[model samples]
Target: MEIDFTNIKVIGFDADDTLWVNETYFREAEEEVGKLLSIYETPNKIDQELFKMEIKNLPTYGYGIKGFVLSMIELAIELSNGSVSNDIISKMLAIGKDMINKPIELLVGVEQVLSTLSKDYKLIVATKGDLLDQERKLENSGLLKYFHHIEVLSEKEEKNYSKLLQHLEIEPSEFLMIGNSLKSDVLPLVNMGSQAIHIPFHTTWQHEEVSHKDGHSSAFKTVKTITDVLNIIY
Candidate 1:
């Protein structure tokens, strides 16, 4: 249970789902929005349309509720031939904002494990989401003090991980990225010669899941829960 994390001076973690429950609110909102759209467009067509909009806007707007809200509004307007009322858009935006304001619920035992590991490793939270929203959630959760650094990224690409490693002045081999998504967290870090410990969440956002390629399998490992990583990594 106390194995050393070899050469790992710093440990990076993904915030959403890894530390707390986040996607459920978004999922519920997405379902509600889908229902609203279904009256005008087929469910499949709405899903496709929204996905297209997300792809177009994601690069500019990045992650979290703002981008998603904008995409929903854009799609609704488009579907309505620019006739979608501001009232409907406002209602959707309000729902998204409410989700953003919802309380942050830490996963069971996360605080205890984090407190224990903080004494040994320099912990940094390397999460990708809406910058202000993520910061607020971290602050409200009362877990910010556990981390030495907090990075709010726009995306979870290899370049993002590489940039963080550079900022920390550590080689990839000397750090580990602990997160929920195999696509975002594990593959990128593993490709960069870093280690990754995937703590699978019960549910993942649709956009967050991607097919796993075989190349990086050797460099990555998975566990049942976030706290399990502490036992295996430390």
Candidate 2:
């Protein structure tokens, strides 16, 4: 679909997979969890239950590595009928720490995209996760200097984007969101009359996925990489 970017004054980018490697680690963790708990349930069944646990705990724990670890521990306790061993729990904790401590892996063309766009448009990060973790990532990414602001939202809904636009003191038409998820980063802004570009990541959490009908809408543009933004805007 042809999208108008002429009115966009602020560009919001989703972090995690949008900026660096994120969902990939979670996928790895899930696989590890499956192995760790395979004695209690099948790997596939454990994987399914873990997702349910995360969704159920989203309200209470929000998002990030710590929350994910807790979900794993809870599932262990449940699946093992409270007999899940301390060694298993400690291993799960190690997994979380390992994930957090891992070095940031920037996607191809992230810096070039940010560097080029920041000069012309006010760039900001509009992502949801543990505030501390996201902050640490931005600090380590060496790309923080390019952003005018960083926002860590609890959820990426229409209301959240509205508040963000109000905070930026820009109208919806002046804001353009770019991210991988159509559910979080594209559709909400499109509903608010803003523009968005979808750059699909190699990995995405199931919860961030949308139905084919909703995802096929012509309100936004989808690109192959962050570098493509340069062509779209210029």
Candidate 3:
């Protein structure tokens, strides 16, 4: 579908996978946690339990490395029937710390795309995660200066995007969101009458994956890479 972007004034980018490596670290941490608990259950069973724990705790912890670490601790306790050792718990903490300290590796052409688009559009970051962590990554990314605004949303539903647009004093039609998650970044904006573009990453969290039935609308476009955005907007 040929969608129009002539009226797009504000371009919003999702920070994690869209700009830099994020979910990759989470996967690595999950593997380490699974191994840590392998004495209690098989690696596959451990992975499933951890995922269930994360989903159950989503309301309480929201999202981010801190929440993930806490879930790991909780899972460890449950799996071991409270017999898990302090040393093991400490190792879980260390896994999270390592993840938090992982180097900020930007996806290809991220800086170039941001640099080019920032010149013609009011660029902003519309992402969901722990506020402090997201801010830290943004600071570390060196791409913070390109964004006119940064929003760390609690969720990325229609209401959240609506509120963000309202706060920015822009019409839904005037905003454009680009990210790797069709569920969080694309469908919600499209449903709210805003434009979006999907740039698939190598990996995606299970929670963020969406089906074709969910993204069948013509209000959004999907490109292979971030730089393809320039071809559409330019």
Q: Which is the leading candidate under lDDT?
A: 2
Evaluated at residue 59, the lDDT of candidate 2 is 99
**Residues 66-112, model 3: lDDT tens digits:** 99999999999999999999999999999988988888999999999
Deviation (Å) of 30 in candidate 1:
1.0
Error of 2 at 90 (Å): 0.5
Q: So what's the TM-score on candidate 3? A: 0.97
Q: What is the lDDT of candidate 3?
A: 0.92
TM-score of each: 0.92, 0.98, 0.97
- Per-residue lDDT of model 2, residues 1-234, tens digit only: 457999889999999999899999999999999999999999999999999999999999999998999999999999999999999999999999999999999999999999889889999999999999999999999999999999999999999999999999999999999999999999999998999999999988999999999888788988999899898899
Model 1 lDDT tens row, 147-202? 99999987888998888989999988889888888888788887777888888888
Q: What is the lDDT of residue 196 in candidate 2?
A: 93
Global Cα RMSD, each model? 2.6, 0.9, 1.1
Ranking by lDDT: 2, 3, 1
Q: What is the lDDT of residue 232 in candidate 2?
A: 85
Per-model lDDT: 0.84, 0.95, 0.92
Could you tell me the lDDT of residue 220 within candidate 2?
92
For model 2, the superposed segments whose C-alpha errors exceed 4 Å read none
